[model samples]
Target: MTQSYKIVIPVFFIGFLAGAGFWYLFSPALFDRVVSEELPAGFDLSELRSGEFRDVDGAHRGSGKAQVLVSPAGAALLRFTDFEVTNGPDLEVWLVKDPDPQKSADVSASQWLSLGPLRGNKGDQTYVIPEGTNPSEWGSAVIWCEQFGVLFSVATLSEAKI
Candidate 1:
């Protein structure tokens, strides 16, 4: 083997490995995770407010329902049903004060609380709203990409009778 071939072969392999890792982290790969969140046992969940998700842009579209649920005792939960969003490196669930958030700036400009990292990009999942946090005060439930500062989806919550 030539001296140049030895160096070229190793360099090529290293580049391939690096590219694979980047793709795995940053690519728009689709994955689904369904979670059936159980409450404290005896109580039933009632929808307080709910909204249908709207895509922020073509690349970061989402479609589903985001429901803010509460129990009889005032325990609150945020749930996403029939949910799917564009997968990203780091996505978070945020309750923002904006009634209608169309851009990423709306999230940062308004009063907001982060529920936490989104459990899954596609599927049914639940996030526990922090104790004493009033879900009613927040108007939008957003799927935000923290790493890139992008808004994937926003749902403008409306009061529900049931």
Candidate 2:
């Protein structure tokens, strides 16, 4: 190999390794935080677990579906699963606390704790609930499908520990 080629090759390999390490350390938590900020208020983060499902109204076929999973504390590992309306219109899911039950009556939407939106499909998204927002105050989660005009949600334990 040429003398110049030897130096270039090592530098390139080192840069690649460094980039990989950085992503490994920050990607999971960073992604989680972004998703959490989008959720509505009143939704508890500790009670979140795998395999939960939230269904919206079918009348408004344009609406969507969503779910949540709360990871161990300090890890900020919250997973959200959602299904967009393929046959009709898209929907947005939020992680709220104790939302108004009357909002599900149609026309108007509920007021949740507000975690944020479940932007995409299932299994690919994660969010981080910021510190100081005591998970103890979380009551339930609300999912509002903008296109279908429906509110789907799940009620959770107020003091459930992650």
Candidate 3:
């Protein structure tokens, strides 16, 4: 191959790698979700609580409703509908004791339970709250950055009218 062609090929490969890395770190992950988890025999799906998400600050943005339900046998479920949030590395869903955490620090200092890693930045997703973890004990649901200690968004939960 010509020397010019060799140089151009290497440059193109490097550029592609850099672009992929940047997208991985900064771009949001999005996939519209549809849930269909089977409940145990005679499972009750009543007893639901829900909350609306709010931005953590000016740069961070989120809009959605978080719905929490406790099965009769004590398993909990967290579902997000029409949900969207700023994407970041190591994001995790949390249930915090504080009804309203004014800042990121408040979340770390308060009691919390990890539901799981965020499935997507924008989607309708459902996460199974581990068995024996009572979601009703806390009043807030959080989108937290585990790696950076950042609060992306939060939802202060309230009982959903039957």
Candidate 4:
């Protein structure tokens, strides 16, 4: 091979590796989420407490609706409906006891329950608060990026006047 060709080959390989590394570090998880999970057959949706999500920190950017539903059997479920937020890495759904947390530092000091990694960046989803965990104690629903300690968004919980 010519000297010029040899140098070009090595440079191309290095460029490829660097591109892959950056993609892995910053690209959001690609999830094609459709079809809402079915609530138990006897679950009642008539009585639900709802809230509206707000942006927290520059990292958390999205608007959505949150709902706390009690089934006829007394099981509590948290559902996010009409939700859309910016994609993030290692995101989680958290029910926070703090009424207002503006940044990562504020979130680090607060008590929270992990509902699990977020299902998707957009659309409707549901999470079952483990048996015996009181949703009432939490004042907001938070989209948290666990890997980067970023709070993506927060929704203040309030009883819907029926």
lDDT of the candidates, in the order given:
0.87, 0.44, 0.83, 0.80
Q: Model 1, 25-121: lDDT tens per residue?
A: 7675555544555445676889999999998988888999999989988999998888888788788999999999889887888988999998888
Ranking, lDDT, top scorer first: 1, 3, 4, 2
Error of 2 at 45 (Å): 12
Worst 10 residues of 2 by lDDT: 59-68
Which regions in candidate 4 have their CA more than 4 angstroms from the true location? Answer: 1-14, 29-35, 38-40, 46-48, 57-59
| Regions more than 4 Å wrong, model 3 | 1-24, 28-43
- Candidate 1 has a TM-score of 0.83
| 1-162: candidate 4 lDDT, tens digit per residue | 699999999999999999997887667744434436555675566435678888765655878888888775668888888888777778899988887777777778999899998888888888988898776788888889898888888888877678
lDDT of 1 at 146: 85
Give lDDT tens digits, candidate 2, residues 37-109: 2444454555443333433444322222223445454433344444322222233444555533434652253
Model 3 weakest lDDT span, ten residues long? 30-39
Cα lDDT of model 3 by residue, 1-162, tens digit: 698998999999999999998887766544332344333456577657899999989877789988897776677788888888887788899999999997899998999998888877877777788887777778899999998899989999988887
TM-score of each: 0.83, 0.41, 0.75, 0.82
Clashes of 4: 1
Model 3 deviation from the true structure expressed as Cα RMSD, one decimal place: 4.0
Q: Deviation in angstroms for 85 in model 4? A: 0.9
